[model samples]
Target: MGKIASAHAYANNEVAYLAWDIDGKIEGCLGFEVVRIYLEPDGSVSLRDDGEEDRVPCAAWVGFKGQRNPHWLPQTTSIWPVQKLSWRDLTLRKRRNRAQLRPSEISVRYEIRPLGDWRPGLEPAPDPVPETVAVAKRGADGRPVLDADDRSVKIEAKAYDGKPRPLGYLGPAVATNAIRVTRWIGPFQSTFTNGVLAAQWLRNVIWEDGVKRPNELMGMISDPKNGIRKYLAGDVLPMLRELFEQAGSFLLALYELDDNELVDLLLANKNRIRLILANTGLVEGEWDVRNSHARQALIDANVDIQHRMFNNSTHIGHNKFVVHLDDDDAPVAVFTGSTNWTTTGLAGQTNNAIIIEDRNVAKAFADCWHRMLNDPLDLPTEFDDGMPDNQQGAPFRTSNETPARFTLDNGAKLEVWFSPNMPARRKSSAIPPDLREIYRLMRKAEQAILFLAFYPGQSGKDCIVGEAIEIGRTDQRLIVSGAVSSAQAMPNYVPGRKNDRNDPEDDEEAVSPHTFTEANVSIVRASRLDDRDLLSDFGGEELTAKGGIGAIIHDKVVVIDPLSDDCAVIFGSHNLGFKASYSNDENLVIVRGDKALAAAYAVHVLDVYDHYRFRAIEAELRRQGKKGWSGFLATEDTWLDPYADGAKGALMRYFARG
Candidate 1:
């Protein structure tokens, strides 16, 4: 076996570094997450020891979001060069220059089973045992401890007779030590196809006045098909530079914009630009991974500016949008989505950018962009119409009459949403208007529901759609990846994803496959395109063909029955995760009464699901091993395409036969 790649597993969940040996080779496939990536003096990578300063390239301690992991144990590691995964998207991890290898914290999960329940006979059963568990203080010396350090899970164990105690001793409770479920990840590729790849000027020839009026320009570079040209982020720069020459003023909000070419372009016309970017996640001084130079260059230019834009601790200024104002100060157009203005964000990654020239829409986005520039900490004012249930700042009591939608002549209707709640001054968790639209679409589904989410946060949030699926009980499918969530837990029913369920905090309303099996929702956690998810005969092999372009389920898209009257699509960078709805500065477009668009998105969903479902199947086969799985596949290897019209029926038959 040859070594195709080596990676550094930063933590329990993330793979911070991946080095694909495109020309050369390495050996030994450990088949686990890579814990430490060391840089040698001569520019080679190592997992055993730390490397030199100048030679050491990109590195980060990307840890798990809500996992109980042992800090002392070796982080997960994996080796590649196998005949499986594709090596596309590896370029995105471009030696994050000038950044040091950061350290990460390990989380411990604590479980307090009653002396009677876990270790019965230790003491008589306490009266009215409500199963209340407490957190422990010490580490691995005596017993397991809970990872309560900034973790999302806050367990209120109702088994013992108490409340969720502070991160310490189990006050006057059972004499049982806690149970620790430490999670560690292995080396894997993260598809960051999060970039804006098209130019508005290039898409259309009919433009009234220099700007393309009523322009519905769309750009997504997930892999190019035969005869289709792949557009890169740099392609948009020349267009923007051209616009920069024309527009008198510009407003922008971005997560990161350190790409040298793009930075040079921005700096070239810095005088007229008003930029709002994210606050650095790293501290000041010493190898800065935040790319402070880009911000410094802008500061030096002295244009109207707002640095320290996002607060990852609270809400991210996760807006990759630009609002251009003409000489008269009238907002002309707006471009937005999940892309950062970085090099990897552009050419090396996957992304989408929609440029809408509707004057009202531009105004709304421009308003939000400027509002955040002034107050980066507090949530912006409710910028759009409210939900159907008479939310605090919504224009209507119900979604049916909300005033956020505007339509084009072609019968294509669009609605815009801004985050945090309204009245910018108060604390609000009011769901964004677009999310309510998602709920509406889920509820309206008479036949099917499909979703590709990057984050499906706590069970409560996922349950909003889950509840809809439960009610509809139709052909439901979900492809979740990148991060783990209790509401949408993976790991299979055999083991039951105990690690995900261990946290008591998600107890009240976490939704998962287990919660929705009664509704028959076919839930599958997505793997990188290179994994064994695709059927070899059914173009699973095409994964190698679509290398670098076969992206992760990064598209936060929802597709309802395309032919139905209420057929709808909700997409754009907005994550369905709880944090996305509650805090981050995100946007979602709700297209209602659009049959053609709905059908297109529906087909796209099928294409994505078919590509990954087999990975889930293969995972099962792997668990069963060579005999049973091999026997099943040997006889039934050739099946109809999962994307075929009668796929549901065929799937039912296959499962029934199996």
Candidate 2:
């Protein structure tokens, strides 16, 4: 016999040693065997047979651990016959027959009642096992298992309520065990990268559109309630703050918002006073309160507040107010933006702005500002000047002659002065000596020519002169004119039709030829001077000519020899019309020698003209063709470049015919 194993248990006041071989052979069998039970903290009861120091087959009962008495020993001899059992087989049988056994141990011949589905009446029944064993139950409330792993005899688990719990319980200790599992599963890396890309894209689109809205998709994502709140509040906000602070005066203008939003913004930034001026029509009705509030805030802050009203018909004149600061002899700054100071212009509409730090540019804008503020040409009738009726007709006076003339830090001086009545001189040949100086300068230019006017043909004589100069120039002659028009002049209309011969003569036709008068001859003259082809159909039968009243050319500029190293002429507002040159209180400042400044003025003039022409062609094509010609016309391309492609080429071809 290799090593006999014997189990002894106290039962019926008798001690018996049941002997079995290592191979599970019943070498010898004695009386009752003694089996001692040791309870474990894991809710398991271990059974050890005496006389087996190696504990060759120590077994532990796992399921339903509680105080109970052993049942099998009492009827040990009642079975068919004694049968030996291996240690492995004993453990396996205990696990399989967990429901049939009590939370106790016993030693007996294995053939007794065949453990499967056999209830040992002598032993107390084992309690029912928990359906779901919480390996690590957390919190005092509901059970939430974080994770679980099952391996036939063993299980691992974990749970998280407010805090994490890492502990577990064992089951079927004789063959099965339990363990606690832990892991980390969250998509942090991917989410962070995606969020960064989204933020960048949002910034670009917002800047391009010049609009901002709280309800937009990106705005929602940046809201405090969203999961990305931390990102917006912490990283994004801080980054924007740094960028805005560093931006100084270069920051572009933001689009306007609704009145409610404007109020909210003002409240949020109560320490800072905001100034706004806009056309009333562009704003919502509710903005009146906001505008009033803004004006009051500026007054309280001891800052100057200026409001200029304009109608929708004067879009170019409406938003032309510019601000210049410091350097009385030289303007150091210029402010231009889409913000109209009205509730709607500042908050609702998308606008863009630029602030030029150059002194010359600033001075030019300041001059424009003073002219608009002082000139009574089109101001509201209710304006008060604190002057008596006798002196009301006198020239306006201000504390300063005008905003400071511009002189650059780089030794360049900008001469911006008023030439009252040059337009009148240009429109009508009633030129005084001073007014004639403007025309004389235009005649003196040598290399290049540049003209910026709102309505090119409003001054008939200026049109003729400009056409003559264009024909005379050996170099490029750039003409910039406004395209915004209220005139309903018919296209391709043949003039010269006095009346319809076939129809009966009406009362209008019955009037004498001497009683009839041309409504806008100046406009016609200007058009003819620019495009000589218009003069060809001057007196045809199909012409339908009309005039624009209260139509004003707001721009005042004329640059000659702009690209050359020699001379240039800049004059305007007093158009080439007779009234502008003689009667109107107009002014024009002529710069004779500075080629560099003249070139800059020329460039600016050309830019406005190119934009006007592009928009005009687009609008006209849309109106006349009605065949979706707008799309082709609206495409943007460099006007200064060769006109050999697309609509630009078409435009060049059309002009070339003239």
Q: Which digits, one per residue and each the tens of the lDDT, describe model 2 over residues 1-658?
A: 2122222111110111122222121112211111223333454453446533222223222111121111101111111112222111222111222212122123232111111111333331122222223332322321222333421222333211112111111111121111111010010000000111111222322322223344443343323344332322222222223322321222111112223333343444333322333323333322223234544554465543244333222221233223334423345554442233222232121112223456566556555555444543343442222111211012432321242344445444333433232222123434444445555655565433445343333322334233434334433233222221212221122224345656645213221110101211111111111111121211111000111212222234566654454555454233333333333333334445554444334433433343334334433434354332211111112221232222222212212121
The best candidate by TM-score is 1
Find the number of clashing residue pairs for candidate 1.
39
Give TM per candidate.
Answer: 0.49, 0.33
Model 2 TM-score?
A: 0.33
What stretches of model 1 exceed 4 Å from their correct place?
A: 1-248, 280-288, 308-312, 347-350, 374-403, 422-434, 459-468, 471-520, 529-551, 623-658
RMSD of 1: 23.2
Query: What C-alpha lDDT do the candidate models reach, one value each?
Result: 0.40, 0.29
Per-residue CA lDDT of candidate 1, range 1-658, in tens? 2322222111111112111121122121111121222333343443333534221111111112222112111111111111211111111222122111122222211111111111322332223223245322323332233354522223343322212111111112211111111111111111223121221112221111123233112212322221112233323443455556775678887767666766776788788788876643434322224556787777788756665343334545566777878889899777665556654455443343445656776787786775565453332232121112211223211221232567754566778776643333223456545466667667656555666554454442443444444544544443211111122434232223444567865445422332122334555544322224322211111121123332234456676655567777666567664455555566666777766455434443444444445444454445454321221111111221221223333222221111
* Candidate maximizing lDDT: 1
- Shift of residue 394 alpha carbon in model 2, Å: 2.3
> Lowest-lDDT window of 10 residues in candidate 1?
180-189
